[model samples]
Structures are given as C-alpha cells and as structure tokens.
Target: MIRKIKLLLLLSVFAIGTAVADEGMWLPSLIHKLNINTMQQMGCELSADDIYSINHSSLKDAIVALDHGSCTAEVVSKDGLLLTNHHCGFGEIQQHSSVEHDYLEDGFWAMSREEELPNPGKTVTFLISVEDVTAKVLENVNDDMTEEERNKAVRKTLDQLTKEAKGDSHYEVYARDFFNSNQYFVFVTETFRDVRLVGAPPQALGKFGGDTDNWMWPRHTNDFSMFRIYCGPDGLPADYSKDNVPYQPKHSLPISLKGVKEGDFAMVFGYPGSTSRYKTSYGIDYTMKVTNTARVEVREKKLDIISEYMASSQKAKIQYASKHARSANYYKNAIGMNEALTKLKVIDQKKALEDEFTAWVNADQARKAKYGEALGLIENYYSDVENDKAREFMTEALLRGPEIFTFAYRVKPMVEMLKDPESNKDRIERYAEFLKIMADDFFKDYDASTDEKVSAALMKIYAQETKPALQPTCYQEIQKKYKGDYEKFAAQMFNKTVFDNKEEYLAFLDNPSPKVLEKDLAFQTAVQIYEKYNEIRNLVDARSDILEKGERLFVAGLMEMQPNKKFYPDANSTMRLTYGKVLDYDPRDGVTYKYYTTTDGYLEKEIPGDYEFNVPARMKELLLAKDFGQYADADGKLHACFITNNDITGGNSGSPVINGKGELIGVAFDGNWEAMSGDLAFEENLQRCINVDIRFVLWVIDVYAGADHLIDEMQIIR
Candidate 1:
C-alpha cells in the first residue's frame, strides 16, 4: 500500500513534470543559445531560429530588476499600464483607500484616464545588458585573502567599474554570478527611477483570504496591479518630474484574449529572487529540522503580540505593519519549508546523496583529507548561532519599532540645535538626522496610546533580555530624564501640541532651545546602547566566517559529487528563465486543482461575513451574468486563471506570464501549496506557479469596471 501510494504520488508529479524539479537549474538553451551582441541588436527579442545562436552579448539587454519586495514588474501596455502581482501592489491600493471609499471592500475603477491616481516615488529599472568585468573587479584581491580585504577589493573594483563604464550615463552597474563560481556577469542597467503608481485592486480582492488561504490551490485572488515608468524631457530617466513623459519600453506583452488550455507550453519572464536547494544535504536537513522550526516559533510569537496590539488600536496597526510584514513573511516561509521538506523527503534524499558523496571522497585520500572536517565545522557553527538568531530577530524588531519611535520624539529638539554651529554639526548631525526622520514618523497621524503600549512592551523585553551592565546605564538615563514615568515621558514627547500648531512645529526648528536639546541627549544615549547590541552581532558574524567558508566548501563538494547530474547553485536574486506548460494539480486527499479558474470562482469563494473573501455586489453581478464576452475561453468558461512551471518566489510576483510568441497571457502571482517550498527547494515533485489569467484582467477592465477606454489603449490580441 505504501509503495502504491508513493508510485501514485510520483505519477501525479510526473503529470505536472514541467512544474517539477530537474537535475540542475533548467536554463533552456533556446533563451541562452543566441549571442549577447545579436540579442542586444534585436532589442532582447528573438525569432525561434535566432534563439538558437544566443551568446554572452545576447544577454546585454536582458535586465535584472533587483531587491523588489515581492516581484518585479514589466510594462505591458503602451499607455503606461504596468503589470505586477496583485499582492505586490496591495499595499499601495490600501494606502489610497479610505473608510468612506472602501477600495479594499468594493474594488476600484478609473472611469477615465485622468482618474488614475499618481503614485509618488515609485520607480522601475531595466538592465540594458551585462559585460564580463571580473578582471576589472578582482584586480585588488588575491585568491587567498581575508574577508575584510576581499570585501574592500570587491568594493574598489565595483567603484572603478561604475566610474569607468558609466561615462556620464544614467545607468548603474552591478557584478553578478553565473554557473556558481565559474562565471561572472556585470550588468549595466538603465534605471527609470521615476516610477509612478497607476492602479491596483483592493486588498480584499487582491489578497483575499490573507495568510489562511496563502500557498493554497484553486485560489481566487485577483492579484494584479498597474504602474507607469516615467522619463525626462530628453526621454531619459530623471529624478521626480511632474512633466515627465511615460517611458517607452523596448518590449511590451500584448494582452491576449485567446486564453491558455491545459498542457499548453508557457513561460514566466522576470527576476526570481533567491533559493537554497543546492545546499549540502546537511545544510538542507539542518534548515528543515532546526532552523525552520525555530524561525516559525519566533514568528508565531511575534505575530501574536503584533495581532494583539494591532487589534486594539489603528496606531498599533500602522506601527506594526513593517514588523508584521516581516513576521508574516518568515512565518509563511517556515510553513512552506516544513511542508516542502516533508513532502520531498529532503532530509532522506540529502542523507542518501551525502552518503554516496562520502563514499566517493573517502576513496580519494587527498579529497577526503581536505573535506573531512568541513561538515563538522558547519554543524558546530549552525548550532552556535541557533539560539542567538531568534533573539537577534526579536531584538531588531523591538529596536526598529516602539524604541525607535520613543527616541525620535524625545530628541527632536537636538536635531534643530545642530544647525547652530559647524563644530557641533559633525557630532550632532547623525543624531539630528535620525531625530528629523523620527519626527516625520511621530507626527504622521499616529495613535499615541498604541505607540505607548508598544513602547512599554519593548522596554520590558529589553529589560528582560539585555545584559546587566548595559541595562543600568541605558534605562537609568531614560528614567532620570523622564522622571521615572514612561507614560508621562511618552505623553510629553509625542504630544501634537507642538506640531498641531504648524507655527510652533516650524518655530521649534528655528530656536536653539537648550531644554529641547537635553531631551535629545537622552534619546541619543538610548541609540548608543542599541549600537552596542549591533556591535555584538558584527562580532558574531566575524567569528562565523570560518563556518560559512566550510559550508560553502561543503556545497561545492556536493555539487562536484553530483558530476553527471547537472546541478545548479541556488538562485542569488538574478534574472532566470523557468519553462513549463499550463497544467492542473492534485495535491492530496482526493483534492484536485484545475490549471485554470474563471470569473465565476471569485463569486464561489465569496463569504458574506468574511471581509477577505467577500465579493462586491457589482463583481457578483458581472459574474452571474457570465459577461466574459471576448475574454471567454473556447469552452465558454470565462478565462480567469492559468498555471505555469516557473521557478519563482517573492520577487517574481509581478512577472509577465508569456507564451512562446512572447505575448502576455497572465500576471504571475502566487505558487501552489505543494510548491510553497520552492523557495527552499524547487521540488520537481509538486511546485507550480499561479497567475491571474490576462483574460480575467481584461474582463475586469472592460465588462466589470466599464473602463473600455483603458482597455482600448492596450495592444490586445484576440
């Protein structure tokens, strides 16, 4: 029976083989086959025949959009309509909403082009291409060098490369890696720093069901957003400009009314952030068994505290969003990691692979002697940092939140004092700068009571966790300055009395007030104590360098061990191509996930009382009428969703789901439940990428929202 179950599982996975793992990172020779120079000349697009000849020069125009929160977006519509995941744009949508006009509750419609709200300070960048500058980058560092020296060498090389290659152009250069340690790619990116928000669906529609429904299948979330990149008078990227024109992209995915069917070949194009599946079996096992569990525990605990406070006050909600977002991310990761590890039997497979490698190494005397102690060193280092990691997260959260808030309000006047004299400028500039930032935060319609509660809770945590020697100096100073009354101190510090009267807030800046500077000194002292904690972390990281090196060696050894089985190192926030076909999934326990869902699914998931899943009346009306029109699939089902075998994570959210024709079919969003572990391990066994079918996006614009004008601007292919 057990064997039968395993066989069934394997068969099910094979049915979705495109979504499953292969030996190494799957780079279709089709994309990389062409030479870099030809690709650049062709503007990053190629014919099937041309794809066969791709080379290093071909990659020059393929840009890497890095450090995006969830996923990067590409411009798809000529009229400045941007495509990105619904979740990535959720925050911006919610930010633009209010109680009176509950965009989150009912969704949004632009009505006309002018009605589109402008997003300030949002930017999208494109890498024009990359060049090999390894010799330029590594000129200062030898193979055998200290970490500090290596870091310095890398910095100098990057600085020189940027200085030389930039040549007065508005481009940023970055050094990247390929094929693990064997190759390097230097990307020169044309950064469109002036990106603006276009439109986004409300949170209820975009992030429907929240964490509970996250990573699950048969999902009904309409996770999509729109943004526009802007350029200056010269048609080049410039700083914020009200008169800036919309950027003209070299390529844009045309909206496809012809929807996908099961088994149809599809691909996702974008920058996928990071993954760790290529680590040693020992590392993977340790992460799954120990690191993931501890991480989950810490996040759950932190979430509990955040939820409690957020539920009580709106101020707490705003203050804790940054904290909550981080906690939720880790919590989600832990859950996904646990599921992936268990489903893949990652530990067992890792053990088997490790055993085979050990046998091979032991038979080779020289290699055996070199690598015998590597695993031990890794194990010892992981164990040492295990306890400290959790505390570090907790500590960082406390410092970032209420503690930072308290210090900011207390030291506002000292920031104003720094402008008094140049000599005092150097000493007080950093603190003054910090205080100004805090003032902006404190005065921003924050709930005083909730801030106080968070501050008090954090103080207690600090008291409990801080070393004895450090506590007295820090807390004593705070207590002495605030008269041993935290509540009173908070009340006086964050009071809007000074700021509510604009004249006073601005005037406070003019006066070189000694009384205000005293309070600032108190806060400065607290910041210093926080700095001490950071110093300790730096020390810990320094000591762990040896272990990190050993782990890297172990990883290298394992890769070498898998000689014939093409193995790729883990993703390091670079652009990658994942190819697969549209397909459905049968997760387990008789549950099956269809490859595509329709507009009707949104209504089906609607719960009248549940805010997250509750559908707006108009949305329900549109679905009930079956008004899909041109967007309807051939079978008459309104094409609302589809699936792909793309290996993606957070940063891949807003990626374009393209066909072989390079047309946009859907906007990439979440991955299936079985594939949540894709971040840790790309389980060829079950992971599948989920996307909002482009048909659904058009349907929402044309039929549901009645924004036919917006639809008309797009290059729609029926």
Candidate 2:
C-alpha cells in the first residue's frame, strides 16, 4: 500500500510545471505535460504533439535507434535514407573491407541504389509509442514485502503489461524502470532488419583527428555515415533480401542550409546511454578506483599489442580496426572521466548532498522513518567492494582481455552435452553445426600470434595488480608449472590448443570426445576462469539489493523533500530530448573558445604524412581551390564542425542536432573535454555537444565525393 501511494505521489510530481533549464534528458511522452511550455519559451516552434503523437506520425517517426541503441540515426529522405556517425558504422565498414580494396582508406559511396551493401545483422528501430505503466508495474507490490518478493512481483506485473501492450501487433514491447525503479514506462517499437550501408567518408576525413582529438574541442572530424533502411513489399520489417525495397518513412528531417550561430536555439533528440547523475559518493569512488582503473590498465596493454600487429600488415590493420577503436574509445573515456571527476570535485559534491539529505531526514520524524537508512545502506554496501574490484579486474584482464577464452567459452555447452552419452544426438549435431558457423566468423578476424601476446601481457598485469587470493584457478597452475611466467604459458597454450587453428577446431568439432577436450589446456583454463568469474559475480550480487533499495528510497525521499523542484531521470538508452543553445565557452581564464570550426582550421591542424592528420590529396585540392559549392556558410568559409550546449552522451553519438524550426543543423558526435564529467553532473558553464555541421556533410557529398545523387533525395531548406 505504501509503494502504491508513493508511486501515486510520484505521478503528481511528474506533472508539476517545474523545469530545469539545459540539464535534463526529458522523456518525449511526458514533454507535452512537463516540458512543452519551457521548450517553446526557449525557441522550439513545434507543439508537443508535433514532436510525439501516436494518432499521427510525428518527429518520433523520423528517428531510429540504431542497433537497439548502440547509436542513433535519423531518416533524412523519404526513401529511407538514414544519417548517423561514421564511427557508428565502423564495424560494418571494417567487415566489408580488405587489403586489396581498402574501403576505410578510400571511402565508400553507393552511386546507385543497386550499389548499396547490405549488413545482415544491422537493424533500425522506430518507436511506435511510449506509455506510463508505473501503476501497473507496482501492482501487488508493497513496502511490507521483502526486496526479493517485491522484485518478483514487479517482474510478474511487467511481463503481463508487456504482453498486453504488444497484443496482436508485430511491434516489440518492453518496460524500463526510471528514477531508480520508482517509475515504469512501456515502449512499443518496430525494428526493421534490412539496414544497408549507403556511404561513408574515408578515415582521412571521418576520423581525421583520431585519438589525439577524440574528446577534445575545436574538432574537425566528419564523424558521419549514411545507411538505408529496406522493408518488405508490405512495408513491414524483414530480413535482408535482393527483392526488398527502400522503406517509405512517415516523416523525415529537412536539412537546413541556414548555418548554426551563437546562442541560437538547439535541441538534441536521441538515446543517451547510461548515466548515474544520482550516484552516491561511495559509488563514484569505486568507479574511479576500480572500474575506470581496471579498464585503463588492461586496455593499455591490449591496445599496444594490437597496434604492433596492425603495423605488421594492412590485412591485420583492417581486421583489428573496429576492435581496436571500440576498446580504445571507452578506455580513454574511463581515464578522462576519472580526471574530470577528480578535477571537478564530483565526489565532494555528492558527499555534500548526502550530508544535506541526512539533515533533512533528521529534522522530521516522518522523513526519518522513510529515508534514515538510505545513506547507511548505500555506504555499508560500497564500503566493502573487494570482490567487486576483483571481478572488474578479471573481466577486463582475463575474460574479455583475451579473445581466445571468450571464443573458447562458447563451446563449453557442447562439450558438456558430449560428455553425456545419453544426450540427444540431434541436439548435439545441431550444436556442432552452430559451433562450426561460429568458428568460421571467429577465425576470419583472429590472429593467434597477436592474441597470444595480448593474453600474456594482460595476464601478467592481472597477477601483479589483483590480490593473489582472487586469482583464477589456472593462475595457481601457472605459478606451480610455469613459474608464474605468463608468456611461456601463453606460448605453450597457443601452440597446443586446437581453438587457435580454424581447420583443427573444425576437425575436432566433427569428431566430439569429452576425453580429448579434458586434455585441452585452453578449454580447461577457460572453464576455471568462468567458474571463478561466477563466484565473484554471486558475491557482488548478494550485496546489490541493499544498494538498489537504498537508492530507490533516497530518490523517493528527495522528491518528497523538494516537491517544487523539477527532476529528470538518468539516461538508460531510452529516447530523450534536451534543449539548449549554440554557444561558446571559456575553457580557462585566458581561453575563449569559438562555437564553430571551419575548413581553414581543418587545414591548419594537418601534419603532412602523419597517420592522424594527413589530408587526402583530393580533399586538399578541393580545400585549396575553395570549392565548397552550396554548402559553404554566408561568410564564404566552409564550416567543418560546431558546438552546442545540448546535453548528450555515448548512445547519442549520431543524434541529430535540430534547430528551433525543426530542421537538421548538424549531427552530434562528441562532447567537449572540459566537461567529461557532464554525464554525472551537468556542467552548465562548460559542457558542450560537439557536432559536424550539416553544410559540411552536404559539401563533401555534393562536391568532394561527387555523390550528388544521394543529396538529391534530401529535402533541403535553404
């Protein structure tokens, strides 16, 4: 009954007309009631209904969650042409590239519809609608119930709600908990599977600045990619086929030729990934010391090893391009997050908030009864994170550090089934076939020698950095048999393991024997590592309930304590809208940064023959000739990128930066370096969303790349 009442109070709070300017990831469904007025006041010309409406198509229909929120993309043409960041499509591009035809170097442009390449596993999901389901999810859930019982009840209710929401439709339905599980919402979606690669600029432009300029400002990276969605004859989601036609979207964004300017109204709409704005001080400390530390330590070694192999040959570089970039991106992010958190004194801020929360709770007996234990519960659970730290280390340095163990772990089930003589032959055969297919894909990108070095180096780091007691069982053998020399062990393991060789692995799969598998050192090590991994996981999970409950109660108490203040939920890969403006900033006392960058700045950053800053000859020629075509701004300078104060994060990489008039101005790709801690705390004075100017994107397509056919499809508003 208490839980139900609390939820009802939360619903009322949700409708209150309090707005936190430039600091929220507002839900599209609730904007009509919660944020429409403020958004309009800030320069949004569209009504709330025009942004999201189930009765008719709105802007929501034009947006897509790329690969279920790994990134975001927007429909730019009536014929299903989609625009996203180049790095978002890096994997597919890398998959289709080879040494002989280096697409990453020369770039890819589909001159005609028939020339576009299909990506089998890629998908684009359009939201059908979102509805609040908090009351339904909390049904039969009460404060009297134990945490486990409450969870079970909520899960049961969510399952039922999802079923009813998807009744008799092809749409996908799922529910997400917001505000620390105090509120619930159900989303209905249509996922189209036949997404195709349409075009991308070469690395020279798309990823021009590379790691050196990744999270920094004044960025000139093009950072954009193009893909097309294909649908079945009836305009429903379908698998990739030659017969599929371009999807006719309900709405598409009109590209604006009127360029960005300082303080102009801007809005970013997409899925921003996970953020912990309400994380306690203890959680922040653990993230800096354990999570980020482990990632930086392990990935540094792994990246160095991969870089060496990549330098060995072009084939090796192509094979590891996407893998290296993916690992390095977050690896650097973790490092920067820690630096920014410490420099900004985020932990101190959280501690002060907790102190105030405690005072508020103590001042009133009623508040005390509801929230007195929240901080205690949170602090107590986080005080002992030894097992959690070890688990993080194990994940980065062993399980995910080396590719071999994870790939080998896949066959564990099949091996177990093979051990049972009474196991069904058909089931075993089907599993074997699946393993064969897996092996084919794995070996295509696998280089045993490179993996061996990475495995050895990362294992050494794990042994040196982590406590000995938490080491996996295989480490015991390494100490006893190999004298703790990880390199020797890795060498012997790689030489003997059939998992390292595709043909050998295929042969072994053809003839299954448990006895033979038991003798395999890599398989034995993988099983032991996974067992220890599970043990640590269980230990950490055992203590997680207290933290979960504490956070929920704390968030609830905060709402009650401050009834008039507006609050926004943290990012959780759900569609959100954030309104701000195109504005410059002062990074330091002496630095006044500009809001935009031009092609001249792009040229100024060039280092001739350098890997990261080398300009392509054709691009250099175009820039030297000042041939920017219709895409150049009024100043007659070709703008490369710009900055806006719009709030964004990881999954928002390719989100469209829309102007007040509901037109695409740029494609948001990164956030400024000064506010790397923006995810945890909105740095109102410093945080900026970096974007590739739309005019620059068009210039590349119309003049440099000569892909004018692609531009003909867009509805350009000059």
Candidate 3:
C-alpha cells in the first residue's frame, strides 16, 4: 500500500514535468514503474527488463555483492571471471603475502588454474529476487505500541516472512528496512563460497598516490583486481575443493574499448552500504562533533603505531598492511567529511528545511496533530550528548583501538563452560581445539608489542577525552596501582599475559582453569571494559529511540505535505541503480577540472624513492615509450581514470560503469574529495564518482604484466 502511494507520487511528479534528473540510489526492481522513462530520456538503450528480471537472466545476474556487501564485483566472462577494486581484495591479498612472496608489493598472478589461491570463509552473493514485504511486516504494528513492542512485532513477522521465502531452497533470505522503517523488502539470494584470487597489480600501481591521492580527482590508481568463482559438480554453491569447476554465470559484461567521453550516458548498479540523506541538523552536529572527532583522534594514533611497525620489516609490513589501509581510509574520510560539512553549510540548510516544515505544519491543524512533536523529539535526543560522546570515544579508543582485548574476549564463553563443573568433557575438548585454531589465525598477523603500545597510547587518550565516571574500572586500577602510568601498566600486562605469546596461550588452553582465567589481567581488563561499554549502551538506548522515531515521522510527514515530489529511500546495503553522464565540474571558482586523466599525469605526480608516489621503472618505461597499444584514446594518450555524476558510496567501490549500450567502460572506485559530505547530503554538481578506465585496467593486466591469457577470457567490443 505504501509502495503504491510512492509510485503514484513519483508519477505525479513526472506528469507535472517537475521531475529532476539523477541524484538518487533507486531500486532496480521498481525502475519499470518509477524511473524507466527518466532513464530512457537520459539515453539508456536498455529497457527495465534488460537490466533486471526474475524470469530470465539479465545484467543483474552479472553483479554480485562481494563478501555479502562489503564491496561489489561484476562478472566479465562466462566462466565467472570477477573484477573488483584492489582495496576490496586487499585483505585476501595481505593474507597470502609473506616476506618470501610479498603479493602486496610484487603483486600476484595465477598463470594456470591450479595456481589460483582459494579464500576460505569468503563469499559472493547474487540476488535471486526482491519482494516488497512492508505490508506483511507492519500488519501487527501500530502507532500506539511502544518502540520496544513495535520492534518485537516487526521482528516476529520478518522472521516468518524470511522463513517462508527461503523454504525448501538453498538461497539465503533476509529483510531490509527502507525509508526509516516505513517500508521493508525481502531479498532471496544465492551465495557461492568458493571464491579465489586470480590476479592483482602491485600496490605501486594499484594504490598509486596512496593516502595523498585517495578520494581526490584526477586519480591515476589502477585500483582493480580479478577473482573467479567455483561451484560444485551440480553447479551449486559449495565449499572449496579440487573437484570444483569454474562457475558458468548466467550473464557477463562485455568490455567496451570505445572509451567514455563527456556527456556519454552511464550507470552504476551495486549494493550501496548506507546513507542518512534525511539526517536533521542536530544529528549532523552530533556526527561531526562526536562520531567523526572520535574516529580521527583514535585512528590518528593507531595508524602511527601500525606504520612504525610496518616500516620495521617486510614481514611486519605485510602483517599490518590491510589493517593500516582499513583504518586510514575512514580516518581521512572523517576529516574530509567534517571539512565539507562545515564549508558547505549543511547544518544551516537543514535548519532552514526544519523551519519550513514547522511553518507548513503550523498552517494546518491536521499536520500539527501528526508531526508537531517531530522536530522536538529530534532536538531533545541531541539536547545532552555527554554520555553519547563518551560512548563514541570509548568505542573507538578501547573497544576498537587495541586488538588484544577483543581477541581475548573471544574465549569468554569457554571460560564460562570451564567454570561449570557439570560441563561435558567432550564439549570442553571441542572448544579448546576451536580456541587453538583461533589462536593460530590471531597470532599470524598480530604483534603483541605493537598492540601493547597501541593500548597504552589509546588508553591515555580515552582517559583524557572522556569524563572520569565513564572511564572503565581498569583505568581506576591503573590510577591506584600503577600511579596513572599507562605505559608501565601496559608493559607489566604484556609481560604477564599469556595472550601475548601464542605458544603459552595454547599451552594454557591445553589445561585450562577457571582460577587462572580469573587471575589473568588482560582477560579481567577486557571484561571490565566490555561491561562498562554495555552500561553506556543501555544509558543511550532510550534517547536513540527518540531520534529514530522522530526521523521516521519527519520523513512520513514530508512525503504527505509534498505529494508531487518524488522520494527515494536511503541506501541500506541493497542493490540500487543510479544513472548519470560522464561529466566534469568546477570544484571551486575559476578551476574547471577535466573529465579524464592520462598516463602523463600519473608520471608527473611521481616522486623518486617515495612509497606513495614512487614510479615503477617498468611502468615509467612503458609510459615514456607511449606503448599503450589499443588502450590509447583518440588523442593517442592512455586514459587513467574518469569522472561521472552517478550517485554512489562506499560499498559501490568496485561497481561497473556501463555505457548506454550496457557495455562495461570503467570500474567505479572512489568519490571526489569535494563531496565527502555526500553520504549525509549529496551535492550533485560537486559529487563525482571516480572510476578507473576499463582500458587502464586492461593495459596493466595485458601489457604491463604480460598476462594476456587473462585478457583472452573477456569478450571485448571495439
């Protein structure tokens, strides 16, 4: 019923000829009713059914959510040759890397099928179908119910709906809320677990310009990697086995050598992680002051410690490579987001919109009765953020900063079983064996000394940034016993804790004792920190509900007040289609940025002996020789990357940029720095999706690495 109203509202907007182009992450399943005309007007050659269909294979079949939506990947060959961003596959690459075979520095390529590296516990999920389940989920819910009761009712229905949707099938079924829980959808998905690494360029090329160039325009990073999917003999999802064969995909994208030019229609289809487009001014203030600030402060210190260890040896570098990149990516984003939010005057704009809503509601008694308390509820939620601020700092500094606490916390259940004298001997033995395996995985990349330093530094910051009452009890112990010397405390804990030494920890696990676990300082500290964190969470739970309810009411009221305006739901890690054109913009006064960058620009940015900007001798030779082969543009230059106005976010990192004819042109990777505030509120003119030209990706794969065998599998169109 709600879906019908939304579609009618959208149709009315088009009927009045007031519908705008672009700037939305629209659902692909509803495009036929809501956006097909607009997309056709924008020069898309394919019909709605060609892009997404349940009865027949379509473009949607080629795209899969990598690792269940951390990133996106597209099949480029019938044999399930998948392409995604290098960073999306960074963790897998780092895991396979070592001092003897540093895949991060030297890159990895499997010349033969037998050489491909299988990734256990990795998966790629394909959407089988999506159905609107809002009516069903909300049937038992009502405005009279408290938020807790409402949630219970909704969860009960969602569980039954998902079970029915997945009945007698191997598919995974889940429900996602949209438009602030005003609507819901159920998705049936197929997940293939046997994913393998095929090839990836070295960090020098894949991550060129590194932190200095990330999220900036004119990007020269190749930023692409290749993988393959394997299936069982019956052609279904299965575990890794030598007997498995390459998956035969229903559809695969055809590569287009006809590079993109400005004004060329383009589209991206992927699972966008999340966006709070309707966030109020108070919420925005909280995000900048508390959320972003805590992340930057905690990570600023964490990255320094990781980098110091990384520089100590190649082994350490490989161990911390993925961890550092993951931390730094968001640390920089938070800084950039704060800057963009302030400079763009987003809070002022939101306040103005709130004022307008207030005026509109006051003009009508009916609206006043429905939405009079919307803004008040939201404001009240943010009225006192002292506890909230402490919570965010605690989360960043203690919960996430040091790896040791969380790693040690994993054995809490095992300790409980040991404490119970009635626990079965076999059950205890099984858990001990499980802990041994976990210890091996944990200690593989962990350096206790590094963690020790991180814990001490972050603990000090947490003490200073948060109020004394919010500090964990462990800090109180430190203050009394260690004379407030966190360094001394950390040193003593590191020396005494069995967790710092894997062999000692495993030996202790062999003959585990409840008394020993109780006396362990690290375990005791972890328990204290987690218990306090939970206390903080409970303190804020009621206030968070206020914000959630206010936002939902505000959105629903706005839709009713403006019946002619078309509204799209915020992203929630579900498949969406956003379309636009290859275009450039002037980021600021008198500075018109170009739509594309070339190999020449890449060389110009090179710095000798610099890790971030150093030029590979082979890459330099090829660039200077102008040996781009067929990948060169009409101007006889090798284009590195291009920009488009298509709306995208984090999880869309490796989505394919398809032209009007549905041929792959580039791989969507980053968003320009000018629009770091885009996740909160999109700035259409400044928000550009940065993509690595498919030609550049191919050039590195075929020419630079001379791995032509991989190229032969793709269907290329000139």
Cα lDDT, all candidates? 0.59, 0.87, 0.88
All predictions: root-mean-square deviation over Cα? 7.3, 2.3, 2.2
TM-score of 1: 0.81
Per-residue lDDT for 1-718 in model 3, tens only?
1223233234222101123566888888988987888888888999999999999998999999999999999999988899999999999999999889999889999998999999998899999999987767777887788777888898899999999999999999999987777788899999999999999999999999998998999889999999999999999999999999999999999999989888999999998998887888999999999999999999999999999999998899889988999999999999999999999898998888788889998999987887888889999989989889989998999988999899888778877678674655677888889889888778889999999999999999999998888888989889999999999999987876788889889988898888877878888888888988999888998577888878877877766766766678788899988999999999999999999999999999999878799888988998999988889999999999999999899999999999989999999999989999988988867889999999999999999888899999999998
* Model 3, runs deviating above 4 Å: 1-19
Tens digit of per-residue lDDT, candidate 1, span 486-516: 5565455446334333345445554445555
Top candidate (lDDT): 3
Q: Judged by lDDT against the true structure, how good is candidate 2? A: 0.87
Candidate 2 residue runs with Cα over 4 Å from true position: 1-20, 420-423
* Candidate 2 residue-wise lDDT, 466-485, digit = tens: 78777888898899999999
Q: Report backbone clashes per prediction.
A: 25, 0, 0
